[model samples]
Target: MTLPFYLRGLLLLTLIGCGWLLWQDTSDDLDSAPTAVVARPTEPAAPPSPVAATASVVDLFPAQTWTPAPPPTPVDTSPPKPPPLPFTVSAQWRFENQSKIVVLHGNGNQYTLCNRCSIPGRIVPGKMLDAHYRLDKLTDTTVVLTYMPLKHASTLRLDTH
Candidate 1:
């Protein structure tokens, strides 16, 4: 499937970031100073101020403890699956126009050809068929029946064998 331009750009940026992170070094400079040597200062340091050894505590208790109610059960909001494909290759016959149309239909969908009357199967318009063909092959004479959702309209390919 063709990826959108934005998605392709995002993937490219991710790959570049990963490559940079993998090759970059993060070590600190050890030659600059040693911890023991740096601890010995040339000048004397000032004394720190005195602080309380322990903090005072105050007790304030609630008369009753209330438990929070559990969150409401999550509702299922997913969309229902589309109906199954209805058409099957009951028989393959060569039309007189020297073209072949694979007919498919579902319980509610109807299949129709450019020239022929609406067949018993699901009828998808031409544009939707084009989108399906973008990722699949339907030219083989061997009828492969499958469930397909008709979502749009376009010109059907009559020349496909």
Candidate 2:
């Protein structure tokens, strides 16, 4: 009489698989079939020119050799400069007698300087271990001192503001 429900389902699945395989086989055969080619008219080839036949091969852009640049020159790195002058022109003023005075402060001591003169009591205001200083020039806002033995000049500016 009749197959069970599970057997019927299995038979239906087998039939579907066989049909799919047959379809794939026919598609492969269609793809492998020869295709027809249509002929087209072709132009006759021209003979090569005599100049081109005699021309030698030449490279328009030649290969270049790479070369590394020379090492950079050594910088002239001089030693660190010495510290600045310790003395500063603290105050400057002119007396009624036309005498210019410059007050210098250094090392916890105040030394009063006059134009073309050393500090009172002959104490050098800008004295250092390596250099001695003498009052060189005086201006309204600047005091210039000459380094002794070296003759190097240094200026001290007063902060008026």
Best by TM-score: 2
Candidate 2 residue spans exceeding 4 A from truth: 1-82, 116-131, 148-151, 159-161
Record all residue pairs in model 2 with backbone atoms less than 3 Å apart, i.e. clashing. none
Stretch of 10 with least lDDT, candidate 1:
152-161
Model 2, 1-161: lDDT tens per residue? 99999999999999999999999999999999989999775977788888787676577898777897789999989854434677866777666656467677766666676644534553333443234666766666677777666566777776554
lDDT of 1 by residue, 108-145 (tens): 44343333434454333232432242113244243332
> How well does candidate 2 score on lDDT at residue 23?
100
- Native-to-model Cα distance after best TM-score fit, residue 150 in candidate 2, in Å: 5.8
